[model samples]
Target: MKMLPSKNLLMTLLTAWIALFTSSYFFYWQITFSSQFTHVFVGCLMLLLIGFVYVKNDFVEFEMFNLKEK
Candidate 1:
């Protein structure tokens, strides 16, 4: 089987998209419920960190899911 072009780029883009979406959701949550900017910022940071860790650990598995070896 032939490999897809820019596989790494695709993986990176997916990871970034996940991270951004998660962090944005958390930020929105914080802003909706929290009155303080500090709290919202902290929540956003935490969510982003968590997303980064998740993506770092799972990206390889995710990439491998659709990849076929020749």
Candidate 2:
């Protein structure tokens, strides 16, 4: 199986790192997100995104077709 593309891998890691730092900051400070519901929603979405990216990177491979999607 072929590896994931470098550009896509960098982007995925970058997004996950930003999300991880942001969420960790909030959790570390024990901030109440009751008033900032949007942050909570975004955090949850980012969590799923991070998990998906991690799984895809580690366990999945994409089919290549002339260097682009088929």
Candidate 3:
């Protein structure tokens, strides 16, 4: 079967999206407990780490759902 052209791009984008969601979750929890800026700072750092992982690994593979062979 032929592979889709946008598959890898979609995977990368999904990874970024998930990272954003997770960071936001931390910020949300942080805001309830203490100062907004402090949590946001930590959240930003977490997001950056997530971004690094995606970039360094070059789109992590989900073997179960991936249609194409790596």
- Model 3 poorest ten-residue lDDT run: 61-70
Taking the candidates one at a time, how many backbone clashes does each contain? 0, 0, 0
- Return whichever of 2 and 3 wins on lDDT: 2
Off by over 4 Å in 2: 1-5, 29-70
Indicate the residue-level lDDT of 20 in model 1. 97
Best by lDDT: 1
TM-score of each: 0.37, 0.37, 0.36
For model 2 the TM-score comes to 0.37
How well is each residue in 1-70 modelled by candidate 2, as lDDT tens digits? 9876799899999999999999888776655667478778889999999999987876545434434665
Q: Please give, for residues 1-70, the per-residue lDDT of candidate 3 as tens digits.
A: 9877698899999999999999888765634545767768899999999999987666455543465653
Model 2 lDDT, full chain set? 0.80
Task: Kindly report which residue stretches of model 3 are placed more than 4 angstroms away from their true locations once superposed.
Answer: 1-34, 59-70
Candidate order (TM-score): 1, 2, 3
Reference-based lDDT, each prediction: 0.83, 0.80, 0.78
After superposition, candidate 1 runs with Cα above 4 Å error = 1-35, 60-70
- Please report the TM-score between candidate 1 and the true structure: 0.37
Report RMSD (Å) for each prediction in the order shown: 12.9, 11.8, 12.9
